[model samples]
Target: MRGTAAADRQSRPGRRALVAADLSMLRGPVSGVVVLPNRLVWAPAPAGRFDLDDPFDRLRVYEIVLREAVHEAELRRWLNGAVLVEVWPHLYLPRGVRQAWEAIHPQLAVVPAR
Candidate 1:
């Protein structure tokens, strides 16, 4: 019965890594300078705020949130849908994190032209 249950789960579609509940929940600022709380983004290095207008800053924010965020609210607070979609192809996320997000949002897989 345990084997059968495992097989059933595997057969189901849309199964993915345990990341955010959904990417659509991301409703953060699209353009602006924002400072993330230490609880969400903290390191041994000096404090550095992320400027959404800058690609590098945006990418860094996404990377940290995707990897270290412990709750969905954290993602929702710092990730905007428009910005996330635009930066999705460029973000260097872990395999599971990337797979989880891409599974729900296949459009993210489409890399934009440089």
Candidate 2:
């Protein structure tokens, strides 16, 4: 998985500016409903209100944060380590975003047993 993700990034012409510096910096809630601010989720769609209890909604929030967040504060505000681990394999992230995160937190690359 790591090899494939890395190869995908290399094939791309330019780097994605959305990649986070590190996952450890995240300090978001592990559960509960969250309404994302407009600044973090504007354009293409309106501000999103997510219910963390629902798997689908949680996935959506994670996807948005990983793709849209521009600052460490935004990342920390919207992401949680435990929740991220649970949803990592299910997240539909860009190659650069996935690779940047999985590179630091290899545990995220380990798919959980079903």
Can you list the residue pairs that collide in candidate 2?
A: none
Score each candidate by Cα lDDT.
0.65, 0.69
Query: lDDT (0-100) at residue 7 of candidate 2?
Result: 35
Off by over 4 Å in 2: 1-24, 43-47
Most accurate candidate by lDDT: 2
The CA lDDT at 11 in model 1 is 16
Candidate 2, overall lDDT?
Answer: 0.69
Give the TM-score (vs. native) of candidate 2: 0.73
Clash pairs (backbone) in predicted model 1: none
TM-score for each predicted model, relative to the true structure: 0.72, 0.73
Q: Candidate 1: misplaced stretches above 4 Å?
A: 1-18, 44-46
lDDT of 2 by residue, 1-114 (tens): 111123344213453434445566567987788889887567443457778888899999999887766566777788876778778888887777777677756777786734
**Superposing all C-alpha atoms, what RMSD in Å does each candidate have to the true structure?**
7.7, 5.4
lDDT of 1 by residue, 15-87 (tens): 3233444566678887788777777566533454888788888888888776666556767787777778778
